[model samples]
Target: MARYFKYKSTADVMADAQSLGHELALADDLSPLFRPVTIGGRKAGNRLLVQPMEGCDGTLDGRPDELTFRRYQRFGGGGAKVIWGEATAICDEVRANTRQLLMAEHTLTGLEQMRRVTRAAHRAECGDDGDLLVGLQLTHSGRYSVRKPLLAMHDPLLDPLIVDKSTGRRVDASYSLLSDDDLKRIEDQFVVAARRAAHLGYDFIDLKQCHRYLLSELLAAKNRPGEYGGCLENRTRLIRNVIGRIRSEVPGLLIATRMNCYDGIPYRGVGEGENFIGQPCPHELPLVAAFGTNPHDHREEDLTEPLQVARDLRDWGVSLINVTLGNPYGNPHVIRPAEFPPIDGYYPPEHPLLGVLRHFRVARQIQAAVPEIPIVGSGYSWLQDFAPQAAAANIAAGHVALAGFGRATLSHPDFARTLQTEGRLNRKQVCRTFSYCTGLMRAKDHPLGQFPTGCPPFDKEVYGPIWKEVEQRT
Candidate 1:
């Protein structure tokens, strides 16, 4: 719903929203960052971060491109405790787009390249004040792949993504029940890739459990009366098993998982397999939506997974918990606190301020529940002015926003540095003028034109040609 302004005072805004039963999020001191928090018993320098985002500039074989290396190198140098690798698939079939990075085949060589380069660069920069901990985010694109059609947990009900076909426009996805072997192979690949990451000097491997990915599918499998479905245990078994195997494979490395509190739908079990994009299906699987065996009912326990998963993995001595709102396209409302899309999204008034503000509200709730665990957060990162608000959510003042603006960060890799020094706040950075960064995904022909995806416009025009050269595989 659109927020109205009759020129209410800040006090009035607080009172009216409070009287209406909306919760108030506390604003904390972002400067102190975090109290000493340890993951796998190792300290994470400061509470700052470089949360996992989709970095698509890998080589054809999945290696990090030169642009990819330089991008993180600067980010690492600028200073962040942890740097999350873009979502890299465990298998070729699970990649979201044919051009996306993978764990199998060509990716190993590329990852080896990334591991060596990033570690060396990060070391040269942060030094003793911090160690750049690298975490690999393993993901499966499922039905939303920008490539040819492939199997998803649900029936192929959604239309394929529009793309210039090698011939005509080819269907960009496929759907079917993954065999036991399929599940095993993907799991094995995760272990191998995670082990490889550890071998190459990365400190951790983050298993993606949020958004509509493969593990999320298992977490959301509804009502199937089988060993792999229906009950929560059945649904989460794959994640558990994968975790166990990876624990053994990369015993010395830290393991982390990002989880969603809910898929934001009532009665929608584990996401109906996410078959469509704009409006078809969650295709073939269910997603974690609060606490019914499916999405039919919300349970308090269901909402507590971040802590529970943290505890469960803690038993295995795993690492941190990175939290985020997963739905951007399927449920923009998740990020936007409005009863409807805000006007700022259109041109001038479309920012959905209330919705974005609400993300902090959710983060605060999660923090209250698990005060001791190291939690990484997003949804309003570019609002550097929200220093106190970010601290209120328990994120350190030094923390950097993961996906704050499509291009805002590009112009300021030191976005967090500025906030740390310049010091101001803008918790409501979403002014209806901003559109979601939907245009930057795997588009063809024009890699990305004048628009910014998740960073500010590059300050150095020379960086473009340099980046293009890096993207060209050696």
Candidate 2:
């Protein structure tokens, strides 16, 4: 493999990571990191993953968009190995955000669009490495949403975004309690979506078991207070049931998850003292959304209990795990600084709830203890940093491997090629645009002009009128 001198004597690799455009690869060694892997026979190229972001880019009524297609297609254009689709609502009634990707096909046209996404990946122009593989993230938002009313693991307070069908005014937090039958119906819908995805030809499925989605909330004590709560077994039942069904039903799909508890083991928490956000290690917390305010003081291997549970789940047959730390609904200010993007409303720093750091050890510990399952380390990171030093840090800490930059990969798809070879990364400029983009993105499909949204272009069109509206109204 071709070699480049390591960033020596405080040489700023981060700067070199910028200015990436023409060249695609940095060195041959970084090639393996970008090549496809034969997973259960199907190829998931490169270790890079396009981390899912909720976008109303899809029609609110549940249809795919050309924008959605092109968005991911660009990531494919950038050449990530596994591309995660925008979170698609399993049930139209249970959407986490109004702008979520809806899998429910209200019409033949809807199915056609989804099919296009699948077909594009297989097209040769996407890359010589073979089209990037696609994976769908199915979510059932339980409580932690700013969206409309919906069903959940437990009844949720009316999400602030709920539009009162009767009065057309905002409603208070209302929990549309779900029953056993309703739960069954929703579960069936998820199955139907998975079946539909398999039918449409997605390579893998990510059961949105992390964050505060229905699966995680159900697994979290928030949803199942009594018999189904407290114990890890009770919490995991929701995910296991989903996995079991998908494995049994979807003949062509592979299943994976982002989780807090591996099995039934309630391991120790990661303290703020040991790990915090931004700083890479030791100071890093847990996986994003996995860190709780109360941290566990246990050493990596101390959790023999959960190790067995992880063993059971793997035995149950989950192939990979995306690790982040923090309770889905607990707190947002923990991981990175609160006003992370430091602008209006953009990608806030990975929430403390996102547990952006727990993977430092939990990932490797799981690898050491379970050792069989593929552990994906995530929480918004730099992939080019995976240069031997970062890779070794990951192994020493316990992450089986790296899940390269989410936005960076989005911006610079050829990150691996550029960083390793040219000693730089050809990145998309808007990445640091952060909250400017994230806030709007987080808002999903709602009309713009709500915030003094950034973007130099906005100065020309909407910002003036928006302020005029505000001034006149006020």
Q: Please report the candidate that would top lDDT against the real structure.
A: 1
Go through the candidates in order and give each one's C-alpha lDDT. 0.52, 0.49
Worst 10 residues of 1 by lDDT: 339-348
Q: Score residue 245 of candidate 2 by CA lDDT.
A: 91
Give the per-residue Cα lDDT of candidate 1 at 418.
Answer: 47
What is the clash count for each candidate, in the order shown? 61, 54
lDDT per residue, candidate 1, 208-288, as tens digits? 877656676556555333566766667677778888988776678888877664554321212122221122234333433
lDDT of 1: 0.52
Error of 2 at 37 (Å): 3.3
Name the lDDT value of residue 235 in candidate 2: 56
